[model samples]
Target: MKKVPFIAVEGPIGVGKSSLAREIANYYQYRLLNEIVEENPFLGNFYKDIDGWSFQTEMFFLCNRYKQLEDIEKYHLNKNEPVVADYHIFKNQIFAERTLQSKQYEKYKQIYYILTANMPEPNLIIYLKAGLNTLLERISLRGRDIEKNIDPAYLLQLTKDYEQFMGKFINDHPNVPVLTFECDHIDFIKNKADLEAIFSKIDDQLFINN
Candidate 1:
């Protein structure tokens, strides 16, 4: 198969985006670009006290993702390697809108829109969907120390927001193919059959279109 130029997998917290991106990259020999949440100094603090550090954490992520996208664009165009990124730049805004106030969202939106205006969109976007209870279970199993106190209600709210936002985004960008998978009943990372099923869906979406 001639490689698709770019692909991205995105979902809410504990949805295994990085896992899927890495697995696909390894499988297809694409360059993997994963988000660096572990490297973000403000992440722990933000998780502990979102009101105080939400803007700081979001701004840091926004800038960091922009840089990654810029680097990916230049590198991929120059060297011609298919690219698989775990998250999209817009995902940060999905969180920011929920965490930030109206004024704060307005301010951030101005900058985000300007920066991403001409950015390259992925050839295919694979979106994972899971129920709130499933999301909480995954979060607990992952056991990130900072995430121990994460409110299930907050996650539920974010899940709703993600669904709405992704729904609208996909509607607006009709040319961008989105493969939405409900993850409430399956664990793609741990279940071999589940992983194969997801991969098969991806293969068909990416290859059959050609």
Candidate 2:
């Protein structure tokens, strides 16, 4: 089969995945699919008390993302243009693993794996990397109310897990090209040059016109 006409940008919170996704979508004139965090009613409470609302939050996101992927799959089957999504569906498992107990994780994984059986995978995945301090600074700069209460230690752990997951992902799926960018030295949000560099990466990896 030809490469899937989909691009996924992924990273832990405070990295510029969403921004880069939006920029790529606009630049390429592709459909944009964003993670629907704002639509989830349980998200605020989940942020405030992860132990209390973790399951609810994760399930809500899993269902929402599955629906989005289903819709995107249908769209792709009918069209040729690419789609740029901020978060890949697999990242939901990352959150669930972090939040759920052993039994809960197993149960959720069974359901998630079944639902995503025919889902479309990205042709190119852009994984953003940032140090804990830089992530903290970006998180503070964003100024989301729920995010203000996020513990620094929790963010650090999430970062470590993200790194491990991406490392394993690369090892297991060598055919799927992944471009990793470290955000400590570059500010794509404010610098045109940085944005151009990111666009160049997308072009080189996905567009085939670089």
User: What's the lDDT for all of these models?
Assistant: 0.86, 0.86
TM-score (C-alpha, index-matched) for candidate 1: 0.93
- What TM-score, over all chains together, does every model reach? 0.93, 0.94
- Look at candidate 2 and give me any clashing residue pairs: none
lDDT of 2 by residue, 104-198 (tens): 88999999999899788887889998998999998898887778778888888999999999999999988788999999999887899999998
Cα lDDT over the full model 2: 0.86
lDDT: which candidate is best? Answer: 2
lDDT of 1 by residue, 1-210 (tens): 454468889998987788889989988888999887878889888888888989999999999998888888887844777899999888988999999988998999999998888787788899988988888888888788878778788888898999999999999999888988888888878799998998898888777556
Winning model by TM-score: 2
- Stretches of candidate 1 off by over 4 Å are 1-4
